[model samples]
Every structure is written in C-alpha cells, then in structure tokens.
Target: MDFERSLDLLWRDKGETPQPTRGRKPKLTLDKVIATAVALADAEGQATGSMSQIAKELGVGTMTLYTYVPGKAELLDLMVDSVLAERDLPGPGDPLPDGWREQVRLYADRTLTVFRRHPWIQGMSMVRPVLGPGLMAGQEYLIATVSDIGLAPRKAAAAANGIEVYVQANAALTAETAQVEQQTGQSTDAWWGQRSVFWEKYFDVDRHPAMTRMWESGGYDVDTCEAVDEAFVFGLERMLDGIEALVS
Candidate 1:
C-alpha cells in the first residue's frame, strides 16, 4: 500500500479514545491518574515526578493515588501504557507491499516518535517480558506484518527484535544528546565541532585511515532527521535480507 494510505488507516486506529473531561470531580479514575502523571513527566523530568507530586497536581492527597494505582511501579507501568496506547498500527489489509522492510521502518519511526517525546523511557531497562497490552499489541502488529512476508515464526520474531532494538538504540542516543546539551549548553553539532579541532591537532590522522577519511569528508554533518530515517531503513533492510536468506 502507498505510505499515505497506510498512514490514514493508522490514524483511524489511533482515534480510539474518548475526550477527557476538563473539570475536576469527586471521583478519580486510573485513566485520569495516568494522564496526570504523564503530563507531569512531560513538563518536569520523570525522576522528579511521584505520586505525591501528581496528587498535588490533581488536587488530591497522596494516598488517593493508590486508589487508582496500587503503587509507584504500577503507576509507572500505567504511564508507559498510557503513552504506548496512543501509537497506531497499520490497518488490516494495509500492510506494506515492499515486504518487511517498510513495515519495520514504519514501526521504528512511530516508536521513535513516542520515545523522543518521553525521553525518560531510556531509564526503563529490564530483561523481563513485556506484559502491557499496548506493548503486546505493537508486537503483535509487527509479527503479523512480518508473517505476511512468508517468513517463519521464529525468523519473524527475530526480525521484530531487530527493529525494536534499532528504535531503542536511536531513542537512547537522542536522549543522551539532549542530556549532553543540557549539561554543556551546546548542541551536538557545536560540541562535536569544538572537540574535533582538538582531536585533529593531537592525533595522527594516518593511525586511523577510516576515521580520518570520514572526518575529512565531513560525513558527520549528515542531517539529524535524515540520518534517523536512513538508519531505520538501512538497518531494517539488511535485517530483512538476512531473514530472507534464512527463510528461503
């Protein structure tokens, strides 16, 4: 399917929600609590947000939050799911036509967009299995799309892993960039440019031919948005190529 057509379908899927009420009331719901926590995290860093903080924002006592979420861990999980629930998958029968590559790229892009907005997601590193319905739904979409390419279940699973890893890696890098800029008061490009001059003067170019060549060629000047798009496509394509070898 054309990209635009696929996106239209995805948007329709993302529209599955009722508008939140504006005024405060006597009762609290898990949805409202999660939304408050998410907004708090968006405005302030996630580390600074707590049940007490969110409760104050919502004009409730700290203990009241527990009525919605059992504890902070559950609150965090709810926050993550609240964000993930906003993601859209390609609609039924609207799967990418170029095999798994396009599907993976689209998935990675959508995921990166979410992580970029919520950079604190980088702090969530666990080997435990994903149980959140939102996350499970995303994985299911990826597996089903990959299965459409005539890939075996195992290979498709691996391919999905590769796509998710790529997205997470990029999100981590983006978050680090933001962190570095905040600390040094310099953009990534500015910081790198200032450091590169020192390196060129101190190090022998001949010692690292590949590094020297890339630096001299100004290859690091690649546009950030374009680089992200290219990386997702390149990595997904190479992964799919490997899977095709295995499946065929």
Candidate 2:
C-alpha cells in the first residue's frame, strides 16, 4: 500500500483528503462503504475478500466505491481502525486506574477483545500500522501510561511496544486455533488427542529430555485448547514482572 495514500484516506475526516459531493441526494457515505466492507470481511475470510465482492454486497458498481475509498488497501486501513475505535480507552481528563500495571493491562485486554471480535484482523500486518485515529488513541494510551512511570522516555515506549508484541502474537495464535477448528470441522481438543499415537509410538525420552521430564511431571496434563488463554496470562505477567522491576 502507498504510505501517503493510506495516511490521506485514514485522516480524510481531518481534511487530509477532499470530501467533494458527487450527488445531491448523497447515495453513499464513506462510513457506509467501510461498514459494508467490514461486514463482508467478517463473514468471509479477509484473504478471500475483494473490492468487487464488497461492491456487490453494497449493491453498487465497484468503480463507485473508489470515489469514497482509494482501494482495498485503504479500505482495510479504515475497517481496522473502525473496529479498533470500538475500544473504550478514556480521554486524558477522564478517570483512569491509579496503578501503572493496571493501565498497561487495560490496554492489552481491550486490544485482545478487539482481535476476538474481528478474528480476520489476525491476517492483517500491523507492522505498518493503520495510523488512523483509532490506532493513535491506543498509542497515546500506552505511551502516556508508561511515561508516567519512572523509566526513561525510550524505555517507556519500548515497554509499551514489548507488551503490544506479546498481545498481538497471542491474539494471532488464538485466531489460528479457531480457524483450524472451523476448517477441519474437528474441535481442537479432539484433533490434538487424535495425535496421541505419535507420542506413544514414536516417543523417545532420551532424545527429548525436556519434554519427557515435563510430561512425567504432569506438565502436559492440561487440555491445550483450554490452556492457551492461561498460557497468555502467564506469559503476560512474566513480561509485566520484568517491566515492574525496571520501574523499581
């Protein structure tokens, strides 16, 4: 996607792009176009989605959409930001949690909530970031939260990013697990247990000492499907612990 093109579309409401009127009746709005595209993506997978498909769903010619959104890439940027705006991150003057750890947790939890609601987001690469108002608000929240603590400016920003990376990675894993279940028509637990024969027949304790030790110690007792969430929390707290040590 063109960098300037995305930024223009993303900040269009802020006057970055022209909002000229096409018809006296105004048949469609940018929000309507983006909303319809989001619904289509939510129903079908994002990879399978296209501008023609969205246009078809909206009952308009595909070319008509270009007037409002530049293309699929820009539309995707809007769609992601639209969903992200659903989060309830408070404004600067609003009452917020007192503890820094709680503030960080709030950001992580809200982001994961968005990911679960829109599993298709797991397919989008946020490395470039949407850079829309929705993402900017989140970035502000994290930066402000960590900056209030005693860490240096860069380290605080780094801490926020570190937490974000862990959250996104786990969110993607959760989405992948759900996608596998949907595609195979088999529950994750059932599919995992189906591979028990591999552990029993091909298992070699000598070759995999760590696994053998963990298994013998009942570390593998939990249902992995159910444990994915627990694993996320465990890892998140460990990361938080390191950050807290920095603060101290």
lDDT of 1 by residue, 41-159 (tens): 76664435877889999998887765545567656766776576567766567655475666766777777777767766656652452346667768887777777667667877787
Best lDDT goes to which candidate? 2
User: For candidate 2, lDDT tens digit of each residue in 25-118?
Assistant: 4468888888888887766645357889888888988777777766787788889899888777976988888787888778878888877777
Q: Model 1 misses residue 188 by how many Å?
A: 1.6
lDDT of 1 at 44: 60
Candidate 1 has what TM-score?
0.77
Q: How many residue pairs in model 1 have overlapping backbones?
A: 0
Candidate 2: residue pairs that collide? none
Native-to-model Cα distance after best TM-score fit, residue 72 in candidate 1, in Å: 0.9
